[model samples]
Target: MAGMDEAVAELAAEHGDLDALLAGLADDRWLLPTPAEGWDIRDQVSHLADTNDICVDTITGGPRPLNEEALKFPTPEAFTQSGVDKGRAMTPAAVLDWWRTSAARNRDVLLQKDARDRVPWGLGMSAKMMATARMMETWAHAGDVRGALGMEPSATPRLRGIAFLTLRAVPYALSYAKVEQPAGTLRADLTYNGETWPIGPDDADNVITGDALEFCRLGIRRASRAQTSTLKAQGALAEAALDNLRAFL
Candidate 1:
């Protein structure tokens, strides 16, 4: 398992990489629609900012903004729409500053936490897991922003956390998809930049092998099985895992 420090480092790197991309964007480009439905580039950053704020509150037992707002909305989708609405109301610079501040605060708080500390993001997760989750989300959203701007994503070693998280969440992904979990364990041998990250039990019967980038994209639903030709799965468990892989709820 990755330690909190390792995961937090990756999270910071992910934030910095995305920040650089956003910093270069023109004011008009902030309005470009990302792959997420009804969300532009600004909306993506807003969601991250808002989510980080909520995460900080959750960790510290402070006022729960997301929980409070959830009560007012009839559905989860509606609650998210409220965030989208809030982001749409802000200027690009404000949205960017909000994200930067919130993201940094989130990292600082996580660094202060013990690795075994559990935090709530709807689900209770270890400090290390939470850090990894933040990194995964930032990378996924960065992909959306890059896609909107016609830029190809630059895969790096940092993706190891995402790939690890996806594999760790196999059962959750299966549950989220309403599919029955397979009895056998599933494994992944994912490669990126000439490095291979092998996840899961050594003796597992089911295995997925492919580029780390494709597997990470699949985990976030940024790419479908058909879209990731480099990916291959063996056994029913592996197939089901690949089909339903998700990085978040």
Candidate 2:
């Protein structure tokens, strides 16, 4: 498991990477459509900025919890749209400034908490876990911005955290999808930079073997089983997990 400091550092690195990407783009390019339907580069950054505030609010016990605020909107889509709408109203520079400000505050707040402390994230998770989730989200959104710019996304060592989160959150993913649990245990054996990162028991009969980047994509619902050429899942639970698992709420 990653310590709180290490996780927060990774989160900071992810943020820095995204910030560099956004910094180079021309203002007009902010309107380019990303792979995510109906979302442009600006919308993506806006959503991140809004979520950063919600994260801080959730941890500080501000006026409302993230889940509670979501309830005020008619549907989850509406709640998400609300954030995008906020971004649309700002200039690209303003949106970037907002993201940087909130991200800094979020990191500062996270650093003040203990690693074992459970925060009010989706399903509630340890501070380390929340940091990892934030890193994963930043990386995933960065991929969106890259795709919009016609850039090919690559894997980094940081993907180790995301892959671990994917495997660790398998049960939550299955439960959220209301899929019946399989009898066999599922294992993930992913490779990145010639390194094999394994998660699960040594004797597990079910296994998912693939590029760590693709596995992260699968876990984030960015790639379906059919979309990945390198990933293979053996046994029932592994197959179901490959198709239905989601690492984000």
lDDT string, candidate 1, 75-116, tens digits = 888877777787889999999999999999999999989888
- For model 2, residues 1-249, the per-residue Cα lDDT tens digits are 236789899999999999999996799999999999999999999999988888888888886568788889998899889989999999999999999999998898889888999897767999888889989988899999999999877578999999888898988888989998798987899998888988888899999998998899988888888899999989999988987879888
Q: Going through the candidates in order, what is the number of backbone clashes in each?
A: 0, 0
Best candidate, lDDT-wise? 2
| lDDT, candidates in the order shown | 0.87, 0.89
- As a whole number from 0 to 100, the lDDT of residue 11 in candidate 1 is 93
Off by over 4 Å in 2: none
Look at candidate 1 and tell me the lDDT of residue 52: 85
Off by over 4 Å in 1: 65-72
TM-scores for the candidates? 0.94, 0.96
Residue pairs whose backbone atoms clash in candidate 1: none
